[model samples]
Target: MACKERSKGDSRDGDDTWRNTSLAAAPASRELGKAWILKRLVHHAPAIFHSFDFPAFELGNAFEDINVQFTEHGYILVGRSQYEAAEGPAALAPTFAAFKDNLCSVLVVNGLEPVPHETVVESSKTATLHRMKTWRGEGVNLLCGAVMEPTRGILVAQQIADDDRWTYSATSTQRDRMLWFERVYLPCGRKCVARMLLVRRPTGVATSPCAPHWKPRRRGIAATPSSLHRNRLQRRGRDSREDGMLVRVRGKILLY
Candidate 1:
């Protein structure tokens, strides 16, 4: 019997169908603009600092309570709270003042960059799946979700919450993890967008110097100084054995 060919839409399982619908209902135009701007910025950022590692930064209290205000001249003001120990309000006053000064200094040096017109600003309370979709549209191709295992560390699986339904039904495969945000168009105005599934691997397996928790190993192979000398003598014995074999072969040839 011939195997039945599945229809394009039919191939989408329940989870995939959910993701497709959720992505379709999302604010695509806004995400498209944000994705374009982020792509440009990421391309220009130095290799050391260019990354999608928001999770790492998010863990810090400094990032948790950030506030941004746009000035009339288009400069954004970013502020954070100062960590202070109790000595009374008087003791905390200097700390607060210093934090304000630091905030101003940081804004002067780094916050002067112009905001892209299409950027979408959301709070930390925003749904992860929605953020994933938005980021994916912005040309961030990584997929993030929760998984359960024996031990949970910073690398535990992403959890799908009630507020977001897009990532809930998707499978734990690499192909399902990747999202494609960019579309190419021909002169005729027909557009094609590519989507790929990326297989997830344990982190820090590559040659890049930035692998987490890596340490250097000692160079060279030698049991000890004496053992090294002994191995050299053993190699010479093997060489003499080969030379004796060659001499016997020559004698045999002469006799023939």
Candidate 2:
């Protein structure tokens, strides 16, 4: 009987060892994927900008709550908000909640770059293409929308533009939590005069960092560090094993 009990104990220890080993290996893979995503965003942003007419523009010195302009080329508008700079990731949840609340008629569009004129007028019209059709011919106005990924901490928005010809391309660099830099592009005869630049904040953290920030929250407020960390994992599409790892990490932190 004693021998059987010992055997059961050994089996339990072996299972625990395997489980722990698996959990330990997962974070490395997740980190690799995160790095890959950042690299891809960086790689693609320049190609999108190369097609812009005026690649650089001097940003106006005055910071306004909202700036709106109507021109023959298109419309231009930018909105700014102030936040307490020291909160880091803690600020993302509330900020993103506000962002999501404002997305009323917006649909998830593909790629954050200037849509080619031909592509916009394509015959077999994708949903985005179909939407483009409504903007074509005669006096078309600027199209406005928000691309949000609450899970990934990414929110790419266009408040106003000169015309419907321009689109935005984004890259995620993990420096700070909410830094952004934007450059205004003057119109170059309906060929998409895009305002392009690395969005920067006062503190220099470029945030809204990934596509997962758009995932709808699964109830409960994310106010604590554990909850924020959990929300991040959910954004990254964490599996049960990863979830367990987080719980263990939280437990360790609590014990310490």
TM-score of each: 0.17, 0.21
Error of 2 at 210 (Å): 23
Q: Which stretches of model 1 miss by more than 4 angstroms?
A: 1-25, 28-41, 48-171, 174-209, 216-256
Q: Estimate, for each residue in 83-194, the C-alpha lDDT of model 1 and write its tens digit.
A: 2122332323343333222321211211223222322223111112222322112211221222112221011011122123245334321111121111112223232221
Q: How many residue pairs clash in each candidate?
A: 7, 25
Best by lDDT: 2
Expressed as tens digits, the lDDT of each residue in 128-163 for candidate 2 is 111221121211111111222322233332211121
Question: Candidate 2 local accuracy as lDDT?
Answer: 0.25
Report how far off residue 187 is in candidate 2 (Å): 40
Best by TM-score: 2
